[model samples]
Target chain A: EAGVAQSPRYKIIEKRQSVAFWCNPISGHATLYWYQQILGQGPKLLIQFQNNGVVDDSQLPKDRFSAERLKGVDSTLKIQPAKLEDSAVYLCASSLFIGGAVKQQFFGPGTRLTVL
Target chain B: DQQVKQNSPSLSVQEGRISILNCDYTNSMFDYFLWYKKYPAEGPTFLISISSIKDKNEDGRFTVFLNKSAKHLSLHIVPSQPGDSAVYFCAAGGGTGTASKLTFGTGTRLQVTL
Candidate 1:
């Protein structure tokens, strides 16, 4: 099976500008997630989607960030008025489900966003 | 607040030696622990994992030890190879059954030299 797919491996934008990143998870996976990883840090969960519905997004920066998983298949994460602090790698991942005999998460090559 | 932590920012080990990476978590509710290895420019790959009920889990050359009483865990790589050099991250998964969400720690970069 093909791994999770993401578009535009890298992006550079000016501060206060808007940008978007896209991800297509592995087929048959029921859970999708978006995470941010700053340099030298671990990936931080931004939002999680269990199919077409959201499971958790408590850690998401609501004021500036928003995400959507249309048709419960692919997902897109957007950041408006990007801040310098938002410069980090955005990763998208998927799992078969939150509850099951399998619990491993498969990750895609992340989109590295650099805000000037 | 940082709930999970990997205090060591980096570690260097000689090839064929033992490489031990440590992690500590502050939450007792975390019952499932996992280790992921990430190479540059690539996403992380799951290495090994252990449930709270067990103390050790092994996979090929990698082993993970969990100490529930201490809220600590360690990943040991035996006969460490240069290819094993990568950033290692430890994650503590919450709850039982299906609701377990993972809280990850700051990664530790490991460098193995020949």
Candidate 2:
């Protein structure tokens, strides 16, 4: 089966500019997530969507970052007025949610955003 | 604060030897732990996992052990292969409504040499 897909494997933008990343999850997956991985650090959860509805986004920076999954299949994460600290890889993941069980999350190659 | 931590930055082991990676978590609410393997320029892939209800789970050459009282966990790879060189991340999940939300640690890089 095909795995999660993301676009523009790499991106570069100037500080204060805006950037957007896209993600298309695996087929039939009910849950999607966005994460940020800074250099030498593990991926940090940014937001989660369960069928186009947000499940969690407490860690997201509302002042600069936003995400949406309109059709519950593909998602987009946007950062406005990007700062140098926002330079990191943006990873997208998806999982099949079945009640209370913890499902395995499949990840995409990720978009590397470099803010100069 | 970091809820999950993999203190080792790197490890090198000869092929055919056993590799052990350790992880510690500070959150008592975490009941499920997982390990993910990642290559440079690639996203992390699920490797193995264990639930808090069990102390050990094994799959082929990989085994995961969880010590609830110590809030620690470990992943063991036996007869390690060169292809096993990658960054390994430990992640934990649990809570009332956020059971699917995972908190990850800064990974440990393992190199299997011949």
Best by lDDT: 2
DockQ of every model listed? 0.59, 0.62
What tens digits encode model 1's per-residue C-alpha lDDT throughout A14-110?
Answer: 9999999999999999889999999988999999998889989999999999999999999999999899999999999898854364477888989
Indicate the DockQ of the complex predicted as candidate 2: 0.62
Q: Each prediction's Cα lDDT score?
A: 0.91, 0.92
Candidate 2 deviant stretches above 4 angstroms:
B96-99
Second chain TM-score, each model: 0.96, 0.96
lDDT of 1 by residue, B1-114 (tens): 788899999999999999999999998888888899999989988898898889999999999999888989999999899999999999888875232477889999999999
Segments of candidate 1 deviating more than 4 angstroms: A98-102, B97-100
Residue A104 displacement in candidate 1 (angstroms): 1.3
Residue pairs of candidate 1 with colliding backbone atoms: none
Query: What's model 2's lDDT at A111?
Result: 98
